[model samples]
Target: MVVLGFMFISCYKGRLLPIEGKVKFNLIKSDTYTLLYMETEKGYPNFNLTIEFNLIQHGKTVKVELLGVYELHILLPAFGPARGIDSLMLTNGLNNLLFTYGSYTDYYAVQVDTCIHVIPIITKFTVYDSTLYGGLVRKPNIYLYPTSPCSVIVKLSPNGRLVKTIPDYDDGFKVYAYPDGSISGTPGYLFYEAEIRDVDLGTNGWCVSQPEIISFLQWLLPEYGFNPRECDDFIQYWGDKLTGSPYYEIYPITLEQIDLICP
Candidate 1:
């Protein structure tokens, strides 16, 4: 049931659009092109008009225009036809309607009439490249990444279900704890149990960037006192063997070696 585009401002009785029977699809215009798509469920509000803008050009106008100095961040009417195939190019005959998507084209302009219906706002996300266990802050600890790194930037919670929930990147981004103590959230980062492996920086390790993986997981998890080291797959075993020689340091950690072991 691909439904998430909704908009209903009100006023267009002679059939410019607002049919409400939820028109399925069959209006491929030409009086200067008029075919729109992507209307989700929330667009049940309807639309008409009441224009007035100068907060630098009230997004130009959805119609009822007088002038237009300029401004952008536009996504009018119920919120979107933005899922892929988008269009709104009409300039005078239709009174102005420019709203492109992705790297954002046309920038922004509005004002239209003559078959325009769309509702699209489903762009959730989740992916990684690598990370696992580290103070992502206020810990229940179990981080790992590897599914859309860098290019996908970083994002998680497409709700694949990791109910253990405890992810917060403070918003300024830059949350990497990866010397192998693995923790991530730059631009975007959200992972949930991928069997976990990748973080064996070994050979006198030296993390490489973002201040050496945040000084190697706060010097390998040491909050005053001393004894706080986890890794042998984060010790917590049962049927797969359990015990106490639990000392895992996938290498790469320093702060003068936690000031030579918890100074």
Candidate 2:
């Protein structure tokens, strides 16, 4: 079974363990998912590490023991094959896992070995027609931020065909960015369109009244790292569209959710 990613933290009941320097995480790829095989370095024989987390399908706390160079078999599905389009809300029971020492009381955060590659962020948009229920996602403004000035390559492989893109999204968007987050010496993001029919608008979000939209966004946007100008722009763009319904149920799409959708 394909399992999603799990966030782990290292903890000790009394004294912190030097597991970071002693242990290593090796990614073993299987047909379905990538398994995290943790091994303690040589000379650290009989060194035991205990990990506790809830199982995905069953809500049971499973405690696994980690020995030196033994295959721990921690399946992290985040690095696995994409779940594809229809898998809208892929929830994981093992969102957070903790490594504990003796007595399983106090928790200490330990560093995990980095053994993974980074991928480009795919920014997608969908416009749902509540009355008709679904429609095309037109002109989605997608912004990309790089460390320094560079050319960005964007590949469009949506479930549906890419209708249109400004500046013509050929192979990629070749432009120089700055430290102040300006693209090609100008400001703004990418825009696009895709067929958004039969998409399920899940009921896992806030149901805010029309009058509460502004104040709600004022508090919400900042928490998600949105600047003042970006927040104002987002509010102006989406706030005007909420006039139809008295109460709008808005869901905040997370990065993990987006990765699962268009990975």
Candidate 3:
């Protein structure tokens, strides 16, 4: 009789082990985008589910075909290793499958029959610029180029300082500046070149010349939205302060008027 009672309890526990619940699927609309949400049971909080499906617009019996399934799980201390805690899986057809459940007394299940819409893409504007400076005492020439004609935002960093975020360039090409004071016409095209005149000397003499123009040009070309290519020097000139104050000033160009000039 005791052995027979043990068999009956084992059968009852096996039946209780399988999770029983229903998943309620819903298509939610946010501004221009659509998402799928699932709610298990009557009072369970809705969880966002990542799913992709094609919308079939037919004259009759419009149905959702689930292309794939996704799962997200979390382990709880008291529940041992609860699998498929707050997760979702959708079928290509209009069927929702019951996954598993959380360890806490929460019931788990899946409900089908839902739909979500896709969002539309929007475009905006931005600005581009290039600049050069004599690292010793001269003010840098901040050249504002013609605005780019796209919806991408262009941010300016001067001496690694976040100057500002410009909106929408009406100019045709992207503008970029190099550390050695060379500007690229486009992101990769090296259109113009300027020699870096180091006023203060460390180991080098009075006028410091950097031989890494080729490499420096390579680095700045990508930032302005162009590929690196060789270009000819446009401006060649020099100046010396013969006065009392040993200050360096950019000749023939002002600090504020260095607009985007390609070689």
TM-score of each: 0.19, 0.44, 0.16
Instruction: Estimate, for each residue in 153-235, the C-alpha lDDT of model 3 and write its tens digit.
Output: 23332222222212223342245545444445433222222322121121311221233323433443343333222221111
Output the lDDT of residue 132, model 1. 18
Q: Which residue runs of candidate 2 sit more than 4 Å off their true CA positions?
A: 1-135, 138-140, 185-187, 197-203
**Over all chains combined, what TM-score does candidate 3 have?**
0.16
- Per-residue error for 146 in candidate 2, Å, reads 2.4
Residues 1-263, candidate 1: write the lDDT tens digits: 11111111111112122212111111233465433322212122222111112111123233211121121112122321211112233443323332322222222222345543223222121111112111111112333344433322233331112223335433222354544334554212242321111111226432223223334444443432123333222222111211111222233233333222211
Regions more than 4 Å wrong, model 1: 1-37, 42-84, 92-166, 174-176, 184-263
Error of 2 at 140 (Å): 4.6
Candidate 3 global lDDT: 0.25
Tell me how far the alpha carbon of residue 238 in candidate 1 is from the true structure, in angstroms, after superposition. Answer: 29
On TM-score, the leading prediction is: 2
lDDT of 1 at 128: 14
Candidate 2: clashing pairs of residues: 10-108, 11-108, 140-192, 142-190
**For candidate 2, lDDT tens digit of each residue in 1-263?**
12111111112122223332233222222234333333333332212223222222212222223211221211111121111111111122322222232333221222222322212122111111112211244334556667876776666655445557665666655556555566663346656665432233344556677678779878877877777766766777666544433555566655554343333
